[model samples]
Target: MLHTLCNVESGRLSRVEAEEEFTVDQLAAKVGMTVRNVRAYAGRGLIPPPRLVGRTGYYGPDHVARLTLVQELLGKGYTLAAVERMMSELPDGAMALGVFQTLVNPWTPSEPEELDELQLAEAAGIPHDPAIIAKLVELGIAERMDNGHLRIPNPDLLRTGLEVIKLGVPLDAIFILLPKLFAQADAVAKTYVELFRSTVWRQFADAGLPAEGWPEIQRTLENIIPLAGQALVAAFREAMAREIEVVAYEELGLDPNTLPSTG
Candidate 1:
């Protein structure tokens, strides 16, 4: 008698020993995608391709997870090319921002360990200027505590400043830009707050609460913060491109002084 793998009543795969490595067929089955689709994604550079285990190509858990994300993003109107760019760019931007944060605003080790202006300057490894720090405080990106120490209102404000700088905008321009830009961001954040509060937070509530929420919060931020920044920047890039085109037209004014008018 011959038998095939079948799901019992739960309609889920039966619990079994999880494999550390999986073959192409197994990976395709696990990812709920076709073998051709997997190969196409690899060819298109949408994800890191599977590792070669001697004669057979084997995929690890990371590949499976990435494949799932790729599939979801594709279904949500993300083109393969865009998805590929996003996949690679997210990590690159995150790593770059991490370095920038270390330079600009290394987090204090713990509470009750406040930074005076001098220590803050030393920790950030930047030249000190009371005026500039005052400007940041005025922007509400930082604030003075009751104890006469400066504190970051939120670390993300520093990260966002670094991201703006990473886009090649100068520091003076950034100081000008962030105030306006972050006002826009405040409106943008409301949508995501609704999304998380309704969906993700509810799901977490259903699951047993862990010893600490910070670890889960950090993991979620790792996924979200970079992606949110990328989305905002893509919009800004499009807007700037349009602005440049218009500026070029205005700069090349059609006035008789600048252009040869058609007679």
Candidate 2:
């Protein structure tokens, strides 16, 4: 799905992906939104209109990406009115915005599933505690629906969490640690973004973001997103090894340096 192209401005090679398209219903499912919500957003100019063929309409991947963004922003309390204004403010219109959005979105998780409280309780093998359900909703893991079903966003995350809970880790302890983890991750993420903005993006902006240079910008941003994740994982592994050595030395009078090492 990846293809190489030359940036017309720089005459340098870059890569882009084949954009996927979907129907309204599929688009709704992709981003965990209702069909009505998608239609409404399209009606209000929040998203671009679909291409028409015969009587059916089809939305492109950009539309799906934009909806994902809208879901995240709205979950964080951004109103539709505010979102519309912000979308309008993007440079060089929707095409640029689409590529820009993909680069900027922190993470892309899988599609969600709608499960009732009873279903979730059974899946996770836990009691149906209202307090815990409320907390989950607050954390954006799930959304309580009008029909009393819960929309589990990032179902894989929920599954992993359930596995840890089943291993006897207290949910309360996990919740207490979540904020600190998020703060550290957020700080590291901002550092990477600021690095891009100050250097690569700054030069692009200085040149006025010429349309021909978009492919290079897209290429630059797309490449960094995964590299940032890899870098974080590497750094965390190194730090954890050091921490583990210290913990073992202090608690069990074990020194890793004295043990036979494997290369």
Candidate 3:
């Protein structure tokens, strides 16, 4: 009787239908759980019971979805107690989605400001190594202007190098790591760009957002790129630390208890 009512009335119910028309058995079956277990979960306040309308009960799809969600979390190694707390204490998915948008979305930069080559070098504090400059010039990293001034061909390389200057590593050592690091950043950037192109663009188009919103969308994504890049670097650093501190330490004949200054 309850199954037939659910089938007949499911289409009539709003997205968040009133919970006064569902029974414990009906909700349990919807989430593939038994009635007694559903009742036990309700008793423990892990799942909320349906509303009672003069002894007839109903639950919305949100209730059914929550049950399935909890089951999935448990299957993914979360304790029932943890799932219960998460259900009670956590905000809805929309909140997390909003945060992801804020974090991952690109933000616009202020209008472009022009800085000349000399200004760029001074701002970046290019070391006065005439020999290195000559090598860079030969390698096409820097170029000579017609007016006899030197110019940086790729400004990002100079900026990234300046940014890492305070890390206490020698320039030669840093050079070894720079190519691989930039390559990793480039790969991660490509992934996000592809995601925006394939997924976000389609989503925006389907939602009928204006074409003018594209810049704002790209800005938000660009803003997110640095954050995502930093996150990847942090994760890599942890993994590298584990390998260097533990795995390689024993092979180097060092005591783990008396590890060298990691600082």
Candidate 4:
């Protein structure tokens, strides 16, 4: 008996713990594919070659699973090239996007808490207003449940916004400011993603992305997810410090050259 492994989120499937093996025709019949298509997929390196035994070849559960996945993706309107790239046989574009989407998380990871409208306002130190609640929903900060409860996706973000509100920034200004800040963050994230696309992934693709090389590539991608955030924070802090010094010199009649030295 063969056990099929389904990774629905990533659109990948594999079979394991099976001793079942089939010839080309049988393999195609089992997966509801043609012999020619199976051979074509094998040629494209979409599926690993069948185990060789003398002049004959035998396909196993892995082939069945991979071919099934390909059929499913095709049925769902994936281009053949897109599928090939996902399998790392063709040049990567969408494939890289999918990889990064899986690897990267833009928001900070934290436990979410549910709150009612009144409780949410208490938490954020804001008044309970339906208009403001609508704004929160628009900003994706809270979700309106069927029962009128609001779901806070990121409580830390709520606390941060509350602190900004406490610092004399008007609620209306916060709304306007958030979109611009998000746009800047999007641009920064794109830069880092493109850097990976052009440098790390391109080199890997050029090397034929061998079976043994995947672990290293995945590890590198995982490392980039956190490192990009850390690098961005370090870069932003230095930029902010310089901007503050210049602002003080111009607006506050302070000596920029007399700024406190870190050393």
Most accurate candidate by lDDT = 2
lDDT (Cα, 0-100) at 54 in candidate 2: 90
In order of TM-score, best first, we have 2, 4, 3, 1
- Best candidate, TM-score-wise? 2
TM-score of each: 0.34, 0.65, 0.37, 0.59
- Which lDDT tens digits does candidate 2 get at residues 1-263? 01111122222312223267788999899888899999998887777678888989988755766687777668756798987776554432334655556654546557778988888888778888899889888877889888989988678778888898899999898777767876897899789878988897778767765666676777877888789989999888877887777788768877767744432
Q: What is the alpha-carbon lDDT for the whole of candidate 1?
A: 0.59
Which is the better candidate, 1 or 3, if ranked by TM-score? 3
Which stretches in model 4 have alpha-carbon errors above 4 Å? 1-101, 104-107, 254-263
* Candidate 1 Cα RMSD (Å): 19.1
Across residues 29-103, which tens digit of lDDT does each residue of candidate 1 receive? 998999998898878775556667678887765566567777767764678777776555322112222322232
lDDT of candidate 1 at residue 136, scale 0 to 100 = 78
Better of 3 and 4 by lDDT: 4
